[model samples]
Target chain A: MTPFDFFILSGLLFAVGLFGVIVRRNVISLFFSLELLLNSANVLLVAFSRLHGNLFGEVFVFFVLAVAAAEAAVGLAIVVALYRYRKSVNTEDFSTLRW
Target chain B: MREVFFYLFAFLSVVFAVVSVTHRNVIKGGLSLLASFVALGAVYFTAGAEFIGIVQVIVYGGAIVVLYLFTLMTMDLKNFGKEPLRTISLAAGGAISLFLLFSILYAGYRFYGGSIPATVSGAKELALPLFYRFLLPFEVVSVLLLVATVGAVAVGRREE
Candidate 1:
């Protein structure tokens, strides 16, 4: 009901997503975590938009949603292509790009 | 009643997200994530962002997660191999995220007792700002989607 409750929700989701991002080895799970991160931000945005009594933040959420979709498309394409080449989705296997 | 539903859905979403993150089966994890998103849409609805709630269900629950699941279908899941948990990394990730969570809560402490105004943001109300004020960004997002589509196709295409 309060903005603080929303802050708690967003923060917990963000924390969970960050942990997944750091600990997960699979590209697919990483993407899931990334999406969660984006969603957490969206939650806060919607909350703040309600707080300010304006639609600007809601409008911005639309852009974020669009960008998230594009990111998912491009990132998944790269992961799938990489899987074709290497036959593995593990992060350790894709370290050829690492210095 | 609204606040009750809001908290219920919010709690459910967070629980589902944790399950999604920690689940061993990727398909099951994706399903859990879908449930989480749907629950979040309910949260949005309770908060009075009706259009956003619907769009969240459609775009996130319907489109994005399904795209992930479809991409998953093309791969052999049996060969995913188990990830060995490293204690050091586990501790690090846990510590860092916990720190972040505390800091975020601290930052928002002043807003703890404050309630947001009751405002219903249906599509009709949302359109005025989106189509009028943010028209340029709207068009740019369209172009961005187009570019992403092209780039994905080019990258995923196999050489003859």
Candidate 2:
């Protein structure tokens, strides 16, 4: 497949991820969407690395993976804590901080 | 052959993502999301990013999705009552995302006319950059993962 094809695929994945983040009310689903968005970006980075015949973009993808794992760990912890205290995982239920 | 795999995996990823977001059962949603991630990894493979495709399948499909599923198992699924399916909000999201997708496709079509180069770098090529150039970030990420693990344990620990 061409790099252009990869770019288009990643772009669609990112758009779907964005839609999920905007429309999903559940925090966990939101997190899943966020990961999808990150992966889409990773896809593009790898494609560019290949297109330019450079390894820099691939290196960046490694760092991104690390950060994503960390984010997932911490984010899930926060969600679990919120669920414990509120007994609900809906975004609206945890909107006490909204002004 | 390559283009065929690309289209196949891309279609699967998009379809599963739609199902993931729309499914009412959170566990099923997480599983569908896992399928989407695996399909995306296939897309990466078709693009000649071998290492990335492997990492995507292992980290995203294996670890992250499993983590989400474990978290989902801890919750009461039946408690997720009637979701507020806002018509206006759904329309707005669909419109914005469709516009974004079209814009990206247009830009890609305009900018990427030449054939992609035939050089395909494997895992060995990625190792040098990971260990040498981006070494500090790599180490820092390890630290970040450690902290996240400890923090998760501390937060999830029950009061005695």
Candidate 3:
């Protein structure tokens, strides 16, 4: 496959993830979108690494994976805490800090 | 052969990702996300990133999605309430993402003809650079993971 094919896949994934991030009100679904966004980046990174004939991009994917995991863990924790305080997962209800 | 599999998996991943994004039920959305991630891993495998592909499935499909599912169990889903479809945000999100998609395609257009070289990046092939050249960053990531774990526990813990 050509690099452009990978670009198409990555771009579509990013767009879909961005749509989800904007439209979805649920925090968990937001996280799902966030994961998609990260995955899209990973796809491009792997493709570029392959194109360059080096292992650096693949190695960097590991770091991205680790950061994604950490973000998921910490973000989920914050969501849970917010849910406990507010009794809702909908973003509109999270207006306590609103000016 | 590889190109066929790459296109197939790429199609599957994008389809599942769209489903994950649009589905109303959070649990179902997460499950579709899992499928999307696995399909993406297959795409990686087709691209010859075997180790990254396997790790993608194990980490994203197995760990992250499951963690989201568990967190869902803690919330009252019945009270999630009706999400009013505002025309403004829908238009905005659609417009922005469409623009971004086109921009990305345009950016990658110059790279159209090049094909990825034939090289299998399995764990063994990847370890040399990962362990030797990028060793410091690897250690930093480990530390970051540890700190994240502790922070998650601290934030999620119940009060005394």
Q: Write the per-residue lDDT of candidate 2 for residues B42-158, one digit (tens) a residue.
A: 877887788888998999888988998988889998887767889988998899988988887877775466655656667898888888888898888888889989998998887
> List-wise, what DockQ does each model earn?
0.88, 0.70, 0.90
| TM-score of each prediction | 0.99, 0.94, 0.98
The CAPRI classification for model 1 reads as high
Ranking by DockQ: 3, 1, 2
Ranking by TM-score: 1, 3, 2
With a 3 Å backbone cut-off (N, CA, C), the pairs that clash in candidate 2 are none
Instruction: Pull out the clashing pairs in model 3.
Output: none
Which consecutive 10 residues in model 2 chain B have the weakest lDDT in total? B110-119
lDDT of each: 0.95, 0.85, 0.93
Candidate 1, B1-160: lDDT as tens digits: 8899999999999999999998989999999999999999999999999999999999999999999999999999988999989998899999999999999999988898888777798999999999999999999999999999999999999978
Local accuracy of candidate 3 as per-residue lDDT tens digits, B30-133:
89999999999999999999999999999998999999998888788998877888888899899999999999999999998978887898989999999999
**What are the per-residue Cα lDDT tens digits for candidate 2 across A1-99?**
666787787787888888988898989889978988898888878878877888899888878888898899889999999888988999999888999
Give the clashing pairs for model 1. none
Candidate 3 lDDT, A34-61, residue by residue in tens: 9999989999999999999898999989
Could you tell me the TM-score of chain A in candidate 3?
Answer: 0.97
- Weakest 10 consecutive residues of candidate 2 chain A by summed lDDT: A1-10
Among all windows of 10 consecutive residues in model 1 chain B, the one with the lowest summed lDDT is B112-121
Query: Which digits, one per residue and each the tens of the lDDT, describe model 1 over residues A1-99?
Result: 999999999999999999999999989999999999999999999999999988899998889999999999999999999999999999999998999
Better of 1 and 2 by TM-score: 1
Task: Give the runs in model 1 whose Cα sits over 4 Å from its true position.
Answer: none
RMSD of each: 0.6, 1.5, 0.8
